[model samples]
Target: MNNDTVIVTGSKLTIDEVAQVAINGAKVGIAPEAQQKLTESREFVYELVNSNVPVYGFNTGVGANKDRKVEADYYNQFNVNMVRSHCVAVGPEASQAEVRAMIVIRLNTLLLGYTGMSPAIAYMYRDLLNHNITPVVPERGSIGEADIACLSHIALTMIGEGDAYYHGEKMPAKEALAKAGLEPIMLGPKDGLALVSSNALAAGQGALVLYELKKLIQLADMVYSFSLEAFKGNVSPLNEEINRVRRFRGQNESAAHVRKLLQDSYLWIPHIANALQDPLCFRCACHIHGAVRDSLHYLEELMDIQMNSSDDNPCVLINQNAIMSCGNFEVVNWTVAFEMLGIALSHLSRAACFRTIKLSSEHFTGLPRFLTPDPEHIIAFGTIQKPFTALDAEIRHLANPVSMDFYAVAGDIEDHCSNTPYVVQKTRKIVDNLYYILGIEAIHAAQACDLRQEKEFKLGIAGRVVHQKIREVIPFLAEDRNLTVDIANAYQLLKSGVLLHALNS
Candidate 1:
């Protein structure tokens, strides 16, 4: 467990902080003011409940059944039934980290006082996270208008009616809560809807994906730098003045980082190139990577809003002393941004696959074909391209837009859908696949660098560190034994952040 604690103030939680709590097991603390707001919001909800004003999902029923009335006497059971019914989400279950992310995100939004949920429910979220009692949540069955179908599993655990993980051990939610010295929450008016009706599932998972991507973009730059050195590629394209002429943020950022990584390398030596122009994969690497960064920036901006703002339907207005039905749950804006990101990552995947292919060709690198240690006897990287390209192909397929593909659900009242969860889920798959693709690319680049005998061919600061790190786990492809083991090791090296740590050190 991380000793660090993330203080949630309802409106200021960051993606990095989310990573800390979700992935690192950091304890969570709610802001005092936010807790007070929860009290006020709960009071307002009771006031409305007594008045019999028939607010949607409050005193009245929800969805197509909105015309149905919910008397105050049945508030507890109605809410419980709502939660149990929404647990229609199917397996495979979400990871413990993902469930933690969902809890924290939902907890933050509840503090905004827009959901009118009981303060006890909010505290339950804090307690669940603090105790490491992660609810077993299914990863599917959400149309993304809201993650009600999926998130209900979390509410199930809150009421001590489902399975949960307590300190990394899976057991009944009741047992987990008891072991953690906590009690099951009693659902009140609107409590069940409050617990499940939000986009937290998608938002939480998406925030993690963004965190990984931030590092991935930097890693992509680092690997590309090493590949440039191995290719003896022209540094003209990376020249600061040339990249700055266009004034694109992502391109300039990628180009500048690559330049920094390639600092003091022989690539900077004027007239060191084998040709005036390298392949587009080598020349436009930064631009392609830049496009990914640019797309990521857009998604992050939208995700920030999604995380902090109220995504509740029938949002409570404490100032106005009223509850208003609204569509704050709609997440199409960020859903499409995720779609665009998938496309951007597809381009990144293709570029990496192309770069790896170029690295193996004798025509491009002037090294023996397939980066063979002994071309006469060893058939090295020739067949290895198939795996990385297959992974890239999967990335290309995952990049296809699916946000707009949905039928009218919920008795046609919820006619539209963003499929936000699936969009974010697919983007995550794209990032994971890139790790393999880039790992293979790194393997090829390191091999090309080792095979280069030119007196002028030398690694820069980042290259030396990356090469050393790769060789530490994955040796030079000395007469190709099982490349599958090598590929797996390279993936682990990149995924483990070993190379990034070395570069930073």
Candidate 2:
């Protein structure tokens, strides 16, 4: 496998790779080590099924039927029946990218061989991804106890029993598989349960959200720097000595970023400071944004572990040759982390919204009201505040945690649950709100840059890149024009990674 391929060998699949395949359509391959492990694990499972060892989901039934023994003659039927019975999701289908992500994540986890599945099953997943045979997984019907109904839809497609989107059309899975030059798989003993009874759906969606959020945070830092510069804010708060005593790693890093972003601005003119003290949003820039950065780092580590962990039930320990029941599918940890993420993102978005509002006010940035070029006869960017109000509301609404809202299900056996997928989906919704809010701020900051027209008070390298980039898509609010198009274009620049690249470079 090469860099273009995400090779799964239990320990090598990173969250980054998962996102690559989910979002960028990167290829996937099972490593030789994983193949060998899968073979040995399958041998143990076969032996357990032959002997009277009572392995769950293999020789025995699953959940509420754990004590019931599965006859050897009905192994295939048991697997297929379990999947067919569990496919109860109802609602609009998930996006193709999301379904593809679940396939990739589930494949990576299964390759670890601790789930006691065959290498061919893992290969089936790889083939689906590479062939773009995304199963039509419904969006609802999951209460966060591992993506059961959702993943089962994909399992149905594997057995050639459900609908799928093949090369951009909804068709029968058997026809789609044939079109993709592939064949349907035959489910063995616990194969269906192994495919669907894990947190892959939530984990996959979370992986994609994390990928987008990483860039959003980077862009947020750059926009914060630009807004502070537009305000001619006092740079003293971001000085090296301020963080030297506190010694928070994230804070120190953020303060350093601030310093670098303002190194070329007039605010750094020795004894020249703007207002002695600026607003908390401006003065405590590092503390506010750095806390979010720290939380993001924590989520990254947690996701790294999750992407590689065996998160299925009845985990098979190949070395011990034993299949044991476990509750690894409980994904509350992931939901809690995402909830924290939503809260932190809401704050950052609030910072962006408030900073933009302050920039529009005459007392804050001292520029013309609404950043209008001629405040006499024009209401330039005044109405610009309206959209941000709604954006802020959505961001705040998404920030509320969903982890504490779940209770027992499945006959009280699964008493706890993580609204994992919804949490991640809401986090992505917050990101969607961030695009507009941050874009609006970028527009205002650029307008303020034009109003000040500081020749000698040049913007720092980071701010300069962003200011120049905004100018390319949206000119200064010279006279009032419908800014809807401008806002969209500015957001496109942010979504395209142009600003982040410029700022970091």
Candidate 3:
């Protein structure tokens, strides 16, 4: 992640490495071993292309035209036509960051050297990233078996067709390539197929999500701990003994996090007057949050493998001395894993929302209704709960699984679809909604903590850190003028990692 260049190799690439190159703008190169294999593979494909043999996408037509043969003279135009004709994607443009990540993933798969693409072809991708020329990829039109429609746009960029963003200016690919001091690439033999056939667009977004989700998971834990403290809830529910007996690693980890956050708190001391037990939202925090943590472990494992694997088809096998077609393009397993993440996040968001509602209700926390300073005169946090409820509903709706929700395409040859892009995009939306929910919880929790402070109650270590940080940006709800400003500031604080840093520090 430092400024040093990342080396792509036959060895598996980690999500961390991709983050370094894509997010940090670090240069990327092909390892010597990968380069050697790339050259050999390209030579082998050229030999087959020259012969009268019919290979899918190499010497003959593609898809339903497999029986039809393409003349060697027309191969170049065939490649160009393949890229241009497939540029039918329609929707909002993906962020340049996502487009960059897609190119990086696609280039890494090519360096695996099984797709019969030359080192020259791979360098074209490297230059695209290094020079900051991003192919303008659309957000829709992919059923996700392979990112044909999306990646075909990228293929168009390579050949100086379609649109690209260069130096922050949207322009024609020919202009962008010239602006970057690069030339248009001519795809040869199987290079066009290799470029167009990939799951890079989806996989790229997944890698970024994994990186962002890590920080959010820890932030969710910190905010929930603050909620428990604000409500003066019993800490017995997070007892290590109970979690240890269950033997669920994620549950135990969640319990430990809560226990650590509650260190030096008054909640642990014996008190007879407190409620005998808290509501399910506070009591089952460990189990629900732990499931989320557990799912993340599984997701990270899948993402790491995905980041390293060759998600391609009709890959050349040099050792077997044959070009074999395959089904490595099926990424439904990863799509399902993302759905599990979405579901887990939905549960966590609902719990956070419930805790917020309970904290503001006199019947639940015995605090002033809506956490208002003066329940008799001042109207504060009254209408604030509407947005939290709305956010929770949105999160829940997006959590519905779409991994099994697509029809066949390409005349049934590419029959199945993974819907990975839609899955990832929905998961990203859930993450967005959860942040506002956390902000609302923080707003209510800070008020409850402030009210308890009036009664000589002490906050836990985690509670103190969150309260202090929120106080820095937003004062307590002394009298409500506009709560939206406060909520926005609190959300920014959460995203800024101020709360998480307390535990780490």
Best by lDDT: 1
Instruction: Please tell me which predicted candidate would have the highest TM-score against the true structure.
Output: 1
> Count of backbone clashes for each model?
0, 0, 0
Task: Provide the RMSD of all predictions against the true structure, rounded to 1 decimal.
Answer: 0.7, 2.0, 1.9
Better-scoring candidate (TM-score), 1 or 2 = 1
TM-score for every candidate vs. truth? 0.99, 0.95, 0.95
Candidate 1: Cα lDDT at 107:
93
lDDT of 1: 0.92
Worst 10 residues of 1 by lDDT: 408-417
Candidate 2 regions exceeding 4 Å error are: 1-3, 503-505
CA lDDT scores, all candidates in order:
0.92, 0.83, 0.84
lDDT of 3 by residue, 1-505 (tens): 2457888884577787787777777778788888887899888888877777678888877777777788888888988888887777787888888887888888887877788976777889999988888888997888788888888999898889888988678999999999988999877787778888889989898888887788887788788888887888888888788889999988999899888887887777776225889999999988999889899999989877776777767878888877877888889988999999999999999999889889989887778888888978888887988999998999999999988877766677666787898899899888878888998898888888888743547778888888888899899878867878988998788877777776688
Candidate ranking under lDDT, highest first, comes to 1, 3, 2
State the displacement of the C-alpha of residue 232, model 3, in Å, after optimal TM-score superposition: 0.2
Error of 1 at 46 (Å): 0.9
